[model samples]
Target: MKPSGSLLKIISEDLMPVTEIDIRALAEIYAEENVYLSVYLPVSRENEHVNRVFVNSRVGAIKKVLPADLRPEFEKTFDMAEELLFEPAVSGERGRIIFASAPDSFLHVYRLAVEPEKSLVLDTSPFLLPLARLRADYEDYGMLLVDSREARFVCIRSDIAEEKKHLSTDLMKKHKKGGWSQMRFNHLRKEAIKSFFSEVVENVQGTCDELQTRGLVIAGPGEAKQELMDLLSQDVRQSVLGVIDVAMDISRDELVEESDSVLHENELSTSKKKADELKNAILKGGLAVAGVEDVRNALEQARVNVLLIVKGSSVPGWICERCQNLQANTRPPEQCDRCGGPTSSVNIVEELYELAQRTGAEVEFIEQRDFLDSDDAVGALLRY
Candidate 1:
């Protein structure tokens, strides 16, 4: 599975009172692009109770969270009278455990005003996708058993001895005594590389094997990676989700970074393979239809994965030829409260319903701006 979030970590904010949670300041939380959840509470929270909500699960996802009481009430807003099912708290009964996809804190604030209903909605963001993206970590951790020229392995459950070198002749002297070579430097280099890998693999394996759940492993900036990856089995080598390409002195710190780093890259899909599919579909043209007729036909068969119809910002009223009924409001009319037919001139939404019902499939109707995407150009997830 791909990493569903970019920056996944926990952060806390304290609001002493309304004096502290300014709408302007709280607004900043929305800036976080991949904020899966934001738990807020007042600054002087004295409640001893702990409350935990599951943001993720192996089965699938929980679409929303209800108060200890009822489902979410979308119409409520700040400075309003209604008691929202659950207002964003500075702290939950439990410490705020956030699962996010970005590194910034401002996103925690910005999301409040931007969402139609942030609470009880569970974790449903079109942007937040499946967990399969992170499966690469399986390959990354596989490096533990790799063998190489430098394999004087050590198995330590924990504990790393820290040694600081002045980077002077003293350091060189120690190297020389170990046959680290002022003369057979090649052999010395080989041993040094081996030692580093042994230390790394033991440490890596210890942490990885101990984990109750899959954790992120970050490796870079040292021969430990080079030596280990080289010696690792082919299958293990491919397990790495990424190589930071930068060096670091400590593997532990890198592990945290890797764990928190989110993969923003999304894989291409059949939906996205727009240009090629359109080219093929056109070449294999069928019973020729265009305009409303073509769109209607595709809808009738539930063959449209996505339908892009040409319409303007607003739809005008239509007068039915049979009943002489005039379409009313653009939003949603009284449903022809008269003849019990459609009161408003049905727009793409009405057609969409018809199309979906005809074929037993449902898809998104992205705005025209979204159409510019090659995948959205024209293709339907045909209904069988």
Candidate 2:
């Protein structure tokens, strides 16, 4: 059985957000070497047969897109991917295959966790909408499970949770009456508790910083849980969603369940808080922009530090075929505003997300649209 704390941790780092450099490198690839192929297949723990069927179908699609000259390379990569697919999936519900062969003699392949979607694309750049959406939509959080004498720190990123730190204190043991009696014993125990809590705070702070955790969940038995919350620095305290009361040694399944619940709650709450911030920024005419067009403009300029979209909101727009500049309007202009290049219609939401990925901006989907009431369901926090 998997350890309780490990139940929800994503074991693989490949599913984490694709970096800006990776996206830029793909974008920079010459069109003559347009052999980049992206394949997406849906997989699940409950149905191996279904996964096989999906892979076989996508493989057939891949063959149709491959040039005769690339057949050998495609075949080799497919065989390796097929072997891994049949060997039981590592985790996650979707499988993504990114295969590219270029003149630089760079042959690359990646099998990653993805949402249920099927697509086969051949272009100079890999089709990244699915990957970007998966990375943006899913969340990562830090969880601190503690009791009077023990604490566990774990990071849950994109549905995978793993314990990063586990600490137990021998300070819980009974003390002898010889050392200045109960008063001294009590004093020493208090000091030890303080020290332990201090260490936990330090470790959690470091982990949260490293993981770039979006939120935090504090859980465990008794007053220690609350004590830890009180001791957290302001920055850490703001990241917390809420405190959950569970035994320090809670079962992995139980921990996963509770942590997910609290974290989700926190996400909703955080969305509201962020929405308010965006609203204030817009009102103050500070380093913020709202409305689809303004947000798109800010993103095009790489000014967005935080991109906020109302949940389930989308706007149809056009993108420059040559320059990839986004225009949040239905009517395609005769030429792009930035480069006078031809524009083609595309989903503005998707284009915005891909642009944000390239700029290393964080994207958040806000459930409460009220905060964006006059802003057309989109807003951004600008870096400048």
lDDT of each: 0.31, 0.67
Report the C-alpha lDDT of model 1 over 166-278, residue by residue, as the tens digit: 11111122443555445577666567656656565555544445532222223444454566666544544444444444433336434333433422121122224433444
Residues 1-384, model 2: lDDT tens digits: 111222212223255433211453443332332344555555556656876776677668768866688777666645544554445565543554443433333344444544536655544445666655555545677789998688899876555567899988999476554546677777888999989999999999988998887778898888998888878899999888778888866787677678878866766777788888888888898899888888888887888999987766667777676777666757778788899876655667766776776788887778746557533867899999
Worst 10 residues of 2 by lDDT: 1-10
Instruction: Name the 10 consecutive residues with the lowest summed lDDT in model 1.
Output: 125-134
Error of 2 at 196 (Å): 3.0
Residue-pair clashes, model 2: 7
Q: What is the TM-score of each candidate against the true structure?
A: 0.31, 0.70
lDDT of 1: 0.31
Among the numbered candidates, top lDDT falls to: 2
